[model samples]
Target: MNDLIPLISSSINDTLASLSHFYAEIILAAGFLLVILADLFLSRRFTQLCFLISLSTLLLLGVQSVILLNTKTVFLFGGMLKLDHTSILFKLLFCFSSLLFAIFIRYNSPLQKHVKGTGDLFAILLATLLGMNLLAMSMNLLMVYISIEMVSLGSYLMVSYISADKAQTESAMKYALFGAVCSAIMLYGISLLYGFTGTLNFNDPAFINALKNVSGLSSGVAISLVFIGVAFKLSIAPLHFWAPDVYEGAPTPVTAFLSTAPKIAGFAILIGLLPVFQSEGGQTNTQYFDFNVILAVLATASMLIGNFTAIWQNNVKRMLAYSSIGHTGFMLMALFAFQGSGFQALIFYMAVYIVMNMAAFLIVDEIEEQTGILLIDEYKGMGKSNAMLMTTFVIVLVSLTGLPPTVGFTAKFLVFSSAFEAYRNTDSAVILIMIITAAISTLVSLFYYFKIPLNAFLRNSQIQVMAPGNSPKAYLGLLLAILLLVLIVFPSVIVKLI
Candidate 1:
């Protein structure tokens, strides 16, 4: 008891010192509280005040994150959280995506009309953003599970917050149940790993040595179980069954947030875990099991399943949900093939993806608002009526398909080049297979992505669709699409930032 008193005092002092490095997260936490209070107290008179506060909070948090970009890596909370350039970049990304999501929710009629109000939704976003920030920086298994559940619970609440119909409620239930199961499996896996290593820090030398001494089959099973939670968040391969229904049923803004921020956060967590599969000298440590082959197989399966299944979907949101899965596979390839420049390439690809996806969904929401049509077939003959909007949508889709004169092409080129470089260095057949699968998936994506333009321009529809108003959503989509073109010509802009 005497010894424990000093230890606890020292620990508290260390934590207080660590708080200096955690200002951005602190601000976000405070913002979450303030937003909730405002929602409860002032929402009756100032309906849009919550939206304004949410946007401001995200903007300020983004600025705070950017300021920390050049700071040295700092491990806080006794190595539970790691603050580095990569984590800062990811945090900024989440903040930016959350900003856009706030705007999207403000403009969304369905969400605005909900009885519960959007203020709670903003609070949920802040919570999820905090979770993702923690996820990006987590180094301890306990921190990982806590951060993941933070994001998952916030996501579940966001989906069900404005449940106006049966579909929305059903989607929430499915997401919550599946997420709970995955979390449980992940917790069990963590316990197994802890039992094996007697430690939870993956970066610890003792943990690696312990894992190396375990049976390959045992370690593999434990690792695979842990990956189930990540796969559920990434919507990769067989674990992606919940995505389509959730995306199709949730509010468009919620779907936008779900597709961009959380998915990237999953990648952030995966990147943090990459060291588990590597040695101190940066070589693949295959003593326990070959993660390369497992990841390669998962990537291939996700690409094939997501892209091929997308072709048959009539609903645009469902189709994009599948496409998000394919993108996850591609990002997984980037992680697997990470070499000298792979990290930069992966971050750039993710940034471009967020831009393209948000723009695409914004356009989809606009079209849905104007015409009350959600089916791709319903877009027939509407091109001539909404020429500018349709043109922007086509450009966004073209970017999504990784075509020329767009940032998507540049992003894909960087990832492919990184993979090729890794293949050359390691002579790994799995990398080669992943590259081939990615190329094929890109081509497969074209058929569905082009369907939007084809239905709008080529096919003739009997129903008279009204032209979309000059709303903020349309302008936001146009701005994002234009940014894609700018990024293509100035790829160095993002590259330098990284």
Candidate 2:
């Protein structure tokens, strides 16, 4: 009893001391509460108040995350969470993406015109942001499950919040059911992992040691089950079926948020789990099935499936959804090939990807609003009417295609170069296959991505339309497009930060 008292007291002291490092999350939680209260009590009088609060909260969180970037790595909450450069980097990414989402939601007409207004959406955004933040920093299996569920529930709510039609409701239902199944599988896997290892901390030596001694078949099953949930979140192949439906059905702003922030958080979780396949000497764990090979196959499959499938998509949102899956493939390759400074490459690619995707979606949403066109064929003759917007869209698409003189090119180069380096170092055929698959997928993506421009510029519309005038969304997207060009010229800016 005496020993128990001392241990409990020490834990309390440690948790209290951890509070300082946890201030940003505390602020996010507080902001979420405040937004809820505002929505309840003040929303009638102040239409834009929730949006303001949400944006401010995200901006503040971004600033705090940047400040924390300088701090050395530390474990908090008795090792349930980690504060490190990687976590801080991803937290900042989520913060920036959420901030942009707030802006995107503010200017979205459908969400604004909904009976419930955008206040609830803002609250949901904060909740989702909180989940992503937790997901990035989580260091334990329990934290992993809780954080993923937090993000998933918030996502389900966001999708269903403004269900204006059957499609939206259907998408939400599919997402919930699919996500529930994945979560159940993941929980079962975690249970089996705990049963085998008697520990939930993947970073713990005991966990790896147990895997080393356990039957390869059992460990492989457990790992594959856990990855099923991660793959769903990432929208990788074989589990990517829900992405197109959800992306097409959800509001464009919500889709934008879904494609960027949650995907990045998924990568953060994958990065956290990578150590399980690594040894203290920084070599692959030969005793287990080579996770790199498995990831490489997944990456290759995602790229091939995503890019090839996108070619047949006429709906712009669905195409981008598949493109996102293709990008996931590239990121998985980066993860498989991770070496010293390779993380920098991954972060850089992710940061650029966020900018490019948000900009593309912003343009898509604006075009959809102005012309009520969602299909590629409908984009015909829009170039002459909405020249500036289409031009920006072209630039963003070019970036997405990873063409030169754009940040996307630089980002892709870094990832591919890192993979090549890994191939050279380890002589792994899987790494080489990933590089080839990435190249082929990039080529495949060009066909669909170019369809946007080809239809907009080359074809003539059946009906004439007035030009789209300047709007905040258009300007925001243009600014992002210009930022991409700037990044190409000065790639070091983001590189140095990472």
lDDT of each: 0.89, 0.89
Per-candidate TM equals 0.97, 0.97
Q: Which residue runs does candidate 2 get wrong by more than 4 Å?
A: 277-288
Q: Write the per-residue lDDT of candidate 2 for residues 161-234, one digit (tens) a residue.
A: 88889999999999999999999999998899889999888778888888767777677788888888888899
Candidate 2 residue 238 Cα shift, in angstroms, is 1.5
lDDT of 1 at 196: 84
Cand. 2 TM to true fold: 0.97
Q: How many residue pairs of model 1 clash at the backbone?
A: 0
User: lDDT tens string, model 1, 20-54?
Assistant: 99999899999999999999999999999899888
The C-alpha RMSD in Å for every predicted model, in order, reads 1.8, 1.8
